[model samples]
Target: MNADGDETPEAAYRLLHERAVGQSPTPGERSLSAAQYDSARADYLAEKRIVAKPGVAIWPPTSQTLMKRLGNGSWSTAMTSLGLTTNSGRTRGTGSFSDDDYRSAVAEFLDAAADGDNRSVTSDSFAQYIVWAKERTAAGAKRPSGAAVRQHFGSWEAAKTAAQA
Candidate 1:
């Protein structure tokens, strides 16, 4: 079922077809493989019955729409419930922060901090860095926590040094 509780066989088939094609689904008419058709049918049935009760596991819980509903409007919670993991051992909302992302954030933070002729990376500076990182990151990208930053660099001074490099 779609957001309005309307049956959407075409949408389901499109999802399956796209998964098979390893690409985003395109609009208009398209053919479906036998397996895609069968999977779409199952998905349709699952969608229809998903909200009948609580705690029912939805197969292919990776669907963003379904996750939003299942998470009670929090996509992060839905991802957590689905056991999503990251290399940093942080869950969703804690930031999908990678080393490269951390480095870039640090660089930006250092630049902003140095604008006032303050080269030191103090606690307040680190806090500001978090805000800067959050604001500059792309939409849907996770926002790293202070802890994540510290973990990445071992200390504020180290992060500052790397950023200056």
Candidate 2:
């Protein structure tokens, strides 16, 4: 609760976390292949955005898939060189990364986007990230991963350091 009588939102967050990783599968909710789920979720989100009204609707891909897909992409260069993100994707985690950590993590995410994991993201939100990564690649920062870091280390920098060693 804040200084007022309002209840804190931590419970809602906990509930979401619980759902992300639960004990057993529900009746009809069989465990889905992460890739398939991600693809489907991307499609679903696209449908929502495209079918809606108002401004120039664009559903970017989820940062997870996009980051690994792009392969350190331009994020590392941008963050390291300019202390800013070149790609317009989520950089900060749940506030775990320091500024430097933020830069590294952002680099990792762009790396994914360049690689094209298309699977790192949850099935429910992708389109925009995919579109952004691909678009950026077309414009310049052409990065494309042969194999996703997540496929082995579950992310980019992990795969990079592992490959380095």
lDDT at residue 54 of model 2 (Cα atoms)? 64
**Residue-by-residue lDDT tens digits, candidate 1, 1-165:** 344454343344345555566664443324443444456546655656643346664443334444355455544443344443212334544556677777777776666666766544343467777765566555555556667788778997787777667
TM-score of model 2 (CA atoms): 0.20
Clash count for candidate 1 is: 0
Pairs in clash, predicted candidate 1: none
- Candidate 1 off by > 4 Å: 1-95, 116-124, 137-143
For 94-164, candidate 2 gives per-residue lDDT tens digits of 23224343334335445555665555533312343344446545778543322322333555455445543
Lowest lDDT 10-mer window, candidate 2?
8-17
**How well does candidate 1 match the true structure in TM-score terms?**
0.34
Give lDDT per model, in order.
0.55, 0.38
